[model samples]
Target chain A: MSHNTFPHADHDPRAVRLAARDGTLVGPTAGLAKGFVQVNLVILPEAQANGFLRFCQSNPKPCPLLAVSEPGERGCAALADDLDIARDVPAYCLYRDGRLDQTVHDVSDVWRDDLVTFALGCSFTFEHALIQDGLPVRHIDEGRNVPMYRTSVPLVPAGGFAGHLVVSMRPYRASDAIRAIQITTRFPQTHGAPVHLGDPALIGITDLHSPDYGDAVSMGDDELPVFWACGVTPQQVLMDAGIAFAITHSPGHMLITDIPDSRVALL
Target chain B: MSHNTFPHADHDPRAVRLAARDGTLVGPTAGLAKGFVQVNLVILPEAQANGFLRFCQSNPKPCPLLAVSEPGERGCAALADDLDIARDVPAYCLYRDGRLDQTVHDVSDVWRDDLVTFALGCSFTFEHALIQDGLPVRHIDEGRNVPMYRTSVPLVPAGGFAGHLVVSMRPYRASDAIRAIQITTRFPQTHGAPVHLGDPALIGITDLHSPDYGDAVSMGDDELPVFWACGVTPQQVLMDAGIAFAITHSPGHMLITDIPDSRVALL
Candidate 1:
């Protein structure tokens, strides 16, 4: 969790992946592997893969699929050169019968041949782009996690996966919000543009300070809360479905990929 | 300005221009030629043309130059194959010594050898794109002119041409505002994306119901007021400087050109 002295903070994606595998880096992967895509990792039995794939397609704003692994395949060649689905992610959350059973650094001991790995696009990519464009991201500036809320906006039902959408909020001045929308629209894979802004109550978020997940950042009097669909929705959906077993990267602890951020940008 | 029974409403750009030139179309040219570029015409003597050109370059959002004519030239071939700048606009505003002298149908009698014409892009181009994308434009839907206000935000001065920026307001729900920003960003030649949103007081506008120019439309309780740098700015600047003599298209009465709307779109 140390932001200052993390040894692998400035390393490349491959090094970051290796460090995670070797147990040297077990913290959030926010600042590591700059300019590379970091993905949310989801592993479930092959029997549930098809249903989840359909769910992702139905809810792209929340769960944009980056790559999918064949059953029992540890590496997703499309996402990385030498990725191990069981160990490359910094932290893993094991769910049993829809409840979080345990949080671990590696899931190698529980790896099964029937497991299918799903790599999903994360907001970190677009955040990097926003910062590069000189737009201030409130959470990053405050050194806190972007606040997330469960909205009344329901996702399209596909198979057994169905749940209300979860969105991450960033506070910005009106002019900055417009520019942020334009900048994020280019990276559709990374949540794209904001789904809603201005009134949090419109989306069923009762209070801005009390987020369902992540820490809430401060909002200025002149700033409005802009919300983007979060990558956490699929995990929430899986939990809601009461799946027998599943594995996912712990929130904010992503799998660094070899793919450059520019590859995913529309223009 | 009968919205239902305009003979040249569905006509081509050339036909609309011909109607204006022949004194058959003396009303506003909002829907005269669909899918064609409409411009704000500014005609001034050669002595002041260089300063105005520099002003346009300094502030692109408010004054996007589409074409410029040679001194005393009656037509700009770059904008249309057959066109007459002095008589093609539906209405002309003759300003004498920084004051509104009179409104006329044509300026052919006043055309001089030392006069220069500047064609600036208008918001009609992007409004077409927004409607095609299924976004509701409040003013367009209510059949009222877009409300414009003079803001405290100053223009980048060039020579003697300088004035506060004028902006057009459109009220939209936060979600639509984001989509509108994305759509307008593609047409930078037509004022581009909004300069401000949410607060009118931040830009020095005190009242939403009473605009400095144009009719105010109703804003829903959930809507945010989005502001764009307006094309009326150049004419306002000319008047503020008290130029000896100048001719400009009257508000809402534009010059229809042969250039298609698609050509001005960035993507």
Candidate 2:
């Protein structure tokens, strides 16, 4: 599947979402809307939405909830003018009984009145800010997914949503690592700051070369592996919760939102 | 030396300076005027002032020059009104021919016609901000001078001023360390943010306990040692430059200024 390419592409957030809805953008939306916010989609039944909200509040670093819809709601009013919960995402992962069942184009046909949509802010917002500030984003440059690890660090459990924290890693030189911390702190709605840095083992991850999820990018001898609370975390926790049914954006196939990145920056 | 005990002192910046001037506050000014900016005082002959200015500009992290005086001057008008640099500081370290010849209460008697005083932003300003923001500053709590280490990290050399960087250490849990970085970044004039965190060996320090200056603080197994560009760095570099004579505020005995700490915070 062809991903969004830069420079020649229109790179408008709404255009990307429209393409996704029309099935013309059926791949990773990583590079599609460069300066806009993209989100991790989570659609759950109203029975589990309250527990999920509590989980997100307790584990803000990992699951920084951007928007939550009313039961059976289809649009997140703050995200975009006409963002359809079932169709705006590039692709959707339909989970059943704590297992990956099938990947689908859209979920409208299967959507239920009890289904609630959640949009969790993704690291791509801060990553774009970092790049704009001239900081090198290792995974993007390497053309791979940001290496992620399931850490031994436990999340503050909220009811049925309980699990260990998951983190995404990006290696930076010592100074740049400090800088990335500052840059990311501005986007609290999007995971905010790094959860841990330096030694990976401190967070209970053993090997840098062997990430539990996503491709492992090489670390420079002088580079420090900076870890941020990942959006994948909510998915992992929701999975561990043994949810009977759920839907999420597939891997890099995020929901493109009309929200500009800087709007999220804090003073 | 009696440190300023919390909650029962005047704690006014001008009061602190007056006490210093009257020889009543003849010790470290750590807790005095808690919310006002304190500065590292450096007085040098006109011949070396230009070189020192260039050095501070080149090595900003360590020697973030806040105010520079005109030739033959002993005042920093912008730092504090009616500020007589020769007597505002509680204690002065007089360096002659690359050595600490003597420390004095005031430099008024030894003041030269060509002397130019410089006030560099001290880490205390940001440290106060950190503590206000509810982050623990180890040295203050432990009642000791902040641990200063000579590192292998070299400073950008300028005419007649060259030396490896000297860093002050502050240990914090991973999350607090991230907060500390963000807080300190707001005060760029005060050695903005940390130069490095995590392993000391990465910056070429072999032993944490064997610090070149100041008292060492304990590090918890989970705490990361955050290193900031210390004010001592400029004094060290200037000492190595072999100036005929120079005067600096003794460690922790900073110049208490009327400038409010929040005045320096960046938006």
Candidate 3:
């Protein structure tokens, strides 16, 4: 389906992904897919699947597992019945021996029998929640990607996977910061509550303006920087561990799922 | 019964209040009755009761009404069955013509037939919630009364009740401050959530060390001062309005009630 054919593209995650799958939508998936769960996709060989699963379990904040596909399975029945591993996502990164081989629009040509797909929860769910709660999400308002940084905080090593934490920055006034924490605490599947807040330097982020990934958003004088464990964390760990034959969704391009946001609220 | 002889002093609200009624527990009712709702008492003549009730309705964050007794009645059945208005509170401040006339142990001798007692929900309930959530409450840790300040933020006026909003200050690290907001949001009866947070100067508090009332606890370098609506707000209004014949519970020495803390949780 084309983007114009789906007028309510932002409301339906499936429709948005379908448009992206058809090459009609190639830009970032920030505002699109409003109420549904958008996930970080990671495909690995059978040998590293168990190790990554253990890594996710150990560091739940960064790698909050939503669903894991059986080896060679293209569809995750729990997320969406019509989901195709090869063509559903807009973009994917192919890795070989821990180095980037190429970026592709479709992974159908490289689909392997021993590959396993993992769908981990992303921060978009909580960002939607924060907006609903009348809290200003700086990055979204500024029309830029949420700035992310590599932190000094280390994740618990699982099997062979090990790396420092990756966090996304969102600036909010102190009162709004508190409210943001409260709203996000309900959605544990979506990276849950914030990892740290205030003083970017304390978390090893040297400068707020110079982020490692994504565009930096404006911060007000009274605003405090709130940090959430980013889904990019897993990719960083995978790269650091020098894993062979892995795939991840390109930054800001996610696997749109059928799960409603309300379904994940702990309350 | 002495404080030591009160068998259910730690577990039961009824036992603790009964001890206070029997002139046994005259000290601060902070730790004596855990999990029970302690209230800030205010007794005014029938002529001023309507005005004060309107005042509370207009400014709920500061003067959350737990229960109000009927005119000439010495008991509030909604709050407790055997609650004696005259003698249950450990101490009472008698105001004549808006002046501090005297401090009385009991108001039985001067109790007017047209007197109406208002039991305001106290921060003690929400403070218990914060402590239970593993948040470090500075005032509680230091064994001092929460610092109170008179702010420039004006309260909505109702008849003779009009004055600046009075707030209680508690310093917490940014993360703990966020958690405190969440925990306090659950207890709406106990002043609900914080009115403001971060810089004390923003809320019109001139100096952190010099408080208008109560002892100022040390705020660490990493901590931000969070301000909640103090139950002393009504007293401040009464003093400002210069009302005739108003009585309030002495600060920190509140009326131990039979209402359980769980009864006030909104969730």
> Which prediction has the highest TM-score against the true structure?
1
TM-score of 2: 0.93
Report the C-alpha displacement of residue B83, candidate 3, in angstroms. Answer: 1.0
* Candidate 3: docking tier: acceptable
- The model with the greatest DockQ is 1
Q: Rank the candidates by DockQ, best first.
A: 1, 2, 3
Order the candidates by TM-score, highest first.
Answer: 1, 2, 3
Candidate 3 lDDT, A64-95, residue by residue in tens:
99999999999989898688878888789999
Q: Where is model 2 more than 4 Å wrong at Cα?
A: A1-8, B1-8
Whose DockQ is higher: candidate 1's or candidate 2's? 1
Model 2 Cα lDDT, one tens digit per residue, B59-110: 9899888888887776667888777788888899999998899999998899
What are the candidates' C-alpha RMSDs?
1.5, 2.4, 2.5
Q: Which ten residues in a row have the lowest lDDT in candidate 1 chain A?
A: A1-10
Where does candidate 1 stray beyond 4 Å?
Answer: A1-4, B1-4
Give the Å shift of residue A225 in candidate 1: 1.1
Please state the Cα-based DockQ of model 1 relative to the true two-chain complex: 0.79
Q: Which prediction has more favorable DockQ, 1 or 3?
A: 1
Better of 2 and 3 by DockQ: 2
Residue pairs with backbone atoms closer than 3 Å in model 1 (clashes): none
Over the stretch B52-140, how does candidate 1's per-residue lDDT look in tens digits?
99989999999999999999999899899789998988789999999989999999999999999999999999999999999998899
For model 3, what is the alpha-carbon lDDT of residue B119? 90
